[model samples]
Target: MLNIADTLHDWCRAARPFALATVVQVSGSAPLPVGTALAVDGDGNVVGSVSGGCVEAAVYELCQEVLKGDAPPTRARFGYSDDDAFAVGLTCGGELDVLVQRIDPADQPHLTAALGEVTSGRPVAVAQIVDGPEGLLGRTLSVSGDGSTEAGAGGGEEWEAVAAAQAGALLRAGRTGRVEVGGDAATCPERLSVLVHTHASRPRMLIFGAVDFAGALSEIGRFLGYRVTVCDARPVFATAARFPHADEVVADWPHRYLAATEVDARTAVCVLTHDAKFDVPLLRLALGLPVGYVGAMGSRRTHTQRLELLRTAAVPEEHLARLHSPIGLDLGAHTPEETALSIAAEITAHTHGGSGAPLSWSTGPIHRRQSAAR
Candidate 1:
C-alpha cells in the first residue's frame, strides 16, 4: 500500500500527474485488500498491482478518465452479476470497490513530503482518507525523521495529529494499524478512522563469509530487497568488484561488525564460513543475539563438528540448536545460486513467521494475503 502511495506521490510531486486506483472495500474472499493500490501514469504505466490482474484493464480506463478530469474521485463498484457471468473482475467471484483519485500537488502537501522521505530510503507514512471523499482519497498525514508533522485536516488537527503519530510509528516499524481519530468522545460528528499501512526501510542481510557463497548471497539478497552486507577477516574477497550488488563490502571481522548493530528479528545473518575457527565463534555471536535468521552452511557431519566447537567455546547446547546448519530449507539445491535461493527463502520464511511448509500441503492461509482484513 505504501509502495503504491510513494509512486503516486512521486508522480504528483513531479507534476507529471497520474491516476491512483485503490481497492476501498471487498466482500467475500477478496483477491486483494482494502488498501491495495496501483498507479497509472499519464503514459499508462503501472507501478503496483491492485488485483491478481482482473480489474487492471478496467481500472486503466478509469485512470484515463481521471486524468482527463471527466470524473470526480468516485468509488467504483464491480461484482459478479447475472448479466455478465464472464465478467471483468476476480475469477473468485468476489466483489471489489475501487476509489480512483486524481491527486493534485496543491492539495496534497503531507503526502508529498512523506513520499520524499520514503524515496530517500527513510521510513514515513502517506496517510490518506480517514474522512471526506472529495480529497479524502488524497488527504495526507506526513511526518519527518525528526517527528515534525503536517496534515490538511484544519479544524480536526489534534485528532488527526494523534492518529498520524500512532500510524507513523506502525509505518516505521513496517506493519499496519487501524486508528480511531475523534475529539469529542461523548458524541463526535466526524470520526476519522484510519487503516495506516507502513512503508519500512529494507531489511539488512549480513553475510559473514566473503567467499563464493557470500558473493552469491549478496546477489540473491538484492532480489530479496535486502541491504546486503558482506564481511570477512581477509580483505581480498571483500573487494567491491567481487560483491558488487552488496550495499556494503566490509573487510572487518564478522563478530566485530555484528557488535555494532542491534541485530533484530528483521536482520538476517548468514555464516557461510565452514571453518570452526572463523565460523563457530561467529555462529555463537549471531545466535546469542535477537537476529531474525541465522544460517550456517556445511554438511551434517560438518555441522556436528561446528556444534561441538561452539560447546567447547562455552555456547549452550540450546543456543547451538538455533543455528540453521546444513543451512537452507530442503529445496535440495547444490549449485551456489540455488543454495543462495534456498537460504534466502528460509530467511524470508523465518522473518515472516512462516513454517517453511509446501503451499500444497498447507490448508488455510494458502498465502500471506497482504490485506487490511488480515
Candidate 2:
C-alpha cells in the first residue's frame, strides 16, 4: 500500500528504527494477495495489514524485536489448523508467509532508489527474502533494473536463486506471480512464494471524444483514480474548462494520440467519439493492441454500425468483439456521472472476472473491504 511506502520513506528520513512485514505468500482462499504489506514500527505502531486480524499481533511483536536488534529478520508462517484454535493463526483457515525484518536506514539506499523511481510516477520492483534465523534473515536481491542492480541480501543455487529470478520477472511485468521451488520440478526442497510488486505510481486513462459524455466520463475517470487525458481534435471543446478534472487536455486526433503513447494492457481507452471519423480509427488502433479495457460509447444500433465500419476497414471481428459498446453494464445509468460509475464498474468486472452481480447472489467467500484495498 502507498501508506506503507510513504511511512517507510518518512521513517527512513527521520532515522527512526522500523521493520517491514510483507505477506509474501498466501494459500487456500487467502484474504490478501502475495504482495500485501504492513509496517511495524519500533513503538509498535502499525500501517497496512497482512491478514484478517490474525497475524498482525505476532508480526508486530517480531517488529519490536527487530527494532531492538534483538531479533534478526526472517520468514514466519501463520495459518489456521484445528490445533491452533487460539494461536497466532488464520481464523479463515488460510495460510500466509510473512517476511519481517529490521531495515537499516543506513543500508537502505537501494530502497530509496526504488522509491525514487516510484515517486516520479515510474514502475520499479523491490525484492527481498527473509528466511532462517536473525543475522542472516532477510536479504534484498537485485534481479533487474533499467540501469544496474544494487546488491540484494540473498543468494544461493537452490531456493534463493529461483525465488529472486521469478520475482524479478514479475516485477518487470508489473504483476504478481507464484513460484513453486525445490526439486519437485526444480531446486532442492519445498516451495517458496516470491511476491513481486511492480510499483507504478499513476495510471493513465485515455478518453477519445469531444462530446458531453466524454467530459462526464473524463470527470468520472478521474474520480476512479486515473490520470485522465481527454484527447480530441476539436480545440473548441477539448479545453480544460470543459473537463476540469482531466490532467491533460489534448486537442489532437485520436489516431495520432493512440500511436504516440504506450497504451499497452494496463491503460483504459474509452471512445466516446461515436462518429465513424473518430470512433472507427480509434477502435482500429485500440483493437490492434492489448489495452486493459476498450470501451466505446454508443447504442446497440451504433455498435452495429461500428462493427460494419470495422469489417469494412478489414479489422477482424474477433478483435471488434473486445470493445464494450453500449459501454457500461445494463445498469440503466442516465446521468453522465452515474454512467461513468457503471462503466468503471464494468471495467473492474472485466479486469477481475467478477460477474457484476450482487454479493448475496454469489457463492463461496465473501470479499471483505480490506481485501479490495489491494
lDDT of 1 by residue, 1-374 (tens): 56566676667678776778877667755687767788777787888877778778888888888988746776687776566666776665677777787766666666677777766778766555534535344455766656666776353544566666676676656665455655465433356656665567787898988888778889999888988988888887778899898998888878888888655557888988888778876888888887777889899999888888888899987777778888899998888888998998898887766899887776653345443412
Question: Candidate 2: where are CA atoms >4 Å away?
Answer: 1-3, 28-30, 52-55, 74-95, 130-137, 142-147, 153-168, 180-192, 367-374
lDDT of 2 by residue, 63-121 (tens): 77778774766778888868866788888777888887777766666676665666665
Local lDDT at 5 for model 2 = 75
TM-score of each: 0.80, 0.83
Model 2: which residue pairs collide?
72-134, 140-152, 140-153, 141-152, 182-186
In candidate 1, clashing pairs total: 1
Model 1 misplacement above 4 A? 1-10, 14-19, 24-35, 40-48, 57-85, 92-97, 130-138, 153-156, 176-192, 308-321, 370-374
Q: lDDT value for candidate 2?
A: 0.72
